[model samples]
Target: MPPLRTAFDALARLRDARAFHPKGARVDGELTTLDAGPWPLPAGSAQVAARLSKGAGVPDGFRDVLGLAVRVPLETGPWDLTFSTIGSLTRILPFPARGWCDASYSSLAPYRVGGQLRWLLARAARDQPKVDASLRAARRLVRGGGFELVLSSATAIGVPQPIARLRLHTVCDDAGQPTFDPMLNHPPGVTLYPDWLTKARELAYAGSRAGRA
Candidate 1:
């Protein structure tokens, strides 16, 4: 995986930002657990730090894949849930999104939650406004009321069930934002499965950190 790491490092250095989702806005948020599907998310609210970005960094007025990284301070540790707009459930490919509304997101890979493989998803809540694909819009959107998302968890052959509501609060500067990495910062019972995939993902993030740091 040395070549993969090197390639990611080069890409990050070339862009002068993250290897992927180079441009983004940071936001302070809160996650309210509602009849949760997993432990640690059962019956309480948690302070959340999040990043919203475009996967390809496409310019405004254009469609691009959207990304969201949410960090919740769990009792076990910080859990980062990163999501991206996916085209389909077959292979979980990345798809372009027009804006904040109607954009679908998924973790792309299953995680072992309570000894069962689960897919996490997020979508704009029904009472959302039309927020465009730009950093400024994200800032304005959050300041106004922010994006309310319906958190969902699904099994391999089952439908995604609504588990919680994640509400973004205020915009924050990126200067002090933590590099969200679930591979290293996940809680005790939540684990990324399929060893090879995790290793590759970890290496990519490591390279990004080294390049962007």
Candidate 2:
């Protein structure tokens, strides 16, 4: 079977198994806001300008004015994943000169559960034809549109479902090449992980039935 097909099969089975939830604590992050109405260095020394003047760059300016931040923990697992309920984009003009894109992702935490979803997904790809077909479709979507494959994870709570939502904000140059816009590019998607508590409840029920037998 093709490599993409194998990967797709693993993801589907992992999703079906509902491996999102595990036992853990609720996850959260520091709060941040967007102050400047838009970008391109607005007019007067507005609140955003004041902050920017004292700072070196855009991300830094946002951190001061809007209280935005970068994901510090980098490679280690995330503290929590944010969910996106709504998303939108728009263009603004007539002043300091600029354009903007926006997106929001809510947040949640997944308890530390065994990587059952990961294991199942890996097993499914062994010889699944349907998985291959899905992979082909996904590849077409990525090429036709502009998308990059990041990573695919599984959860039990919203297993077989999507919980977190992500939004990307970019700044376009004269040539139309988009540069990174820290203010808007955050918590890329809405993510739903399984709830360990719920999983435990279900397990308890299953155990009770076995005892009766």
Candidate 3:
């Protein structure tokens, strides 16, 4: 069988076995808009299904990963976007005390701006004396439309440029089991980089599926 098909089969078996929900404290949010930009994107709203959990199953309140799975309707069809707090572009994992608001998201293993990639990361508020202060500032930004989503180079550190902004309307009940396959569920113009990291991810996804199955 083809490698792609083999990977899909593994993911399918995992789904059938009901084994995809080991981590992530799921939450609900709204994808209000694309946040006006140069790129051509349909103006529509979609539900944001997200998961907040530690990257290494560490203790709560430690450095964690925020997973966002969005399915947006477009002229072509449904466009799905899957991103993580710790961007794949970066090799270093963020420190635990960095907090969620300070986390970042990226697309493509190698970062590039204006390349059909939507990256999100929070910048620390200047002059904040404490971590809590920064967290509060981040929270306020999200609440007040100050949180910006931009297309730019993915960095292990530094603020992401603003291309779009997300305002989380509410937190809904978790979806019992949610599965996201970038290979099967990406937007029309977006694609994974042809790189070893992408291949590794495919294998990891297949392995996770098989393990769950």
TM-score winner among the candidates?
A: 1
lDDT of 2 by residue, 8-109 (tens): 345435444212111111111221222212111122221110000111113211321011111212122222222211122211111111111122111222
Arrange candidates by lDDT, highest first: which order? 1, 3, 2
Position 108, candidate 2: lDDT: 23
Output the lDDT of residue 21, model 3: 28
Of 1 and 2, the candidate ranking higher by lDDT: 1
Of the candidates numbered 2 and 3, which has the greater lDDT value? 3
* Candidate 1: Cα lDDT at 95: 85
Q: Give each model a TM-score.
A: 0.93, 0.18, 0.58
For each predicted model, how many residue pairs clash, with residues at least 3 apart or on different chains? Answer: 0, 30, 2
Specify the highest-lDDT model's number. 1
Give the alpha carbon lDDT tens digit for every residue of 1-213 in model 3.
446546655765655542232344444455545453533345655555544334444444444444444454556756555555554345234333355445455442542235543343433333322222133333443445333333233344565444444444333343564555665555555555545656766766676666465
Error of 3 at 73 (Å): 3.7
Estimate the overall C-alpha local distance difference test score of candidate 1: 0.83
Rank by TM-score (best first): 1, 3, 2
Candidate 1 on 69-94: residue-level lDDT in tens? Answer: 99988767788889988765442677
Off by over 4 Å in 3: 1-21, 34-40, 75-77, 86-97, 108-160
Lowest summed lDDT window (length 10), candidate 3: 126-135
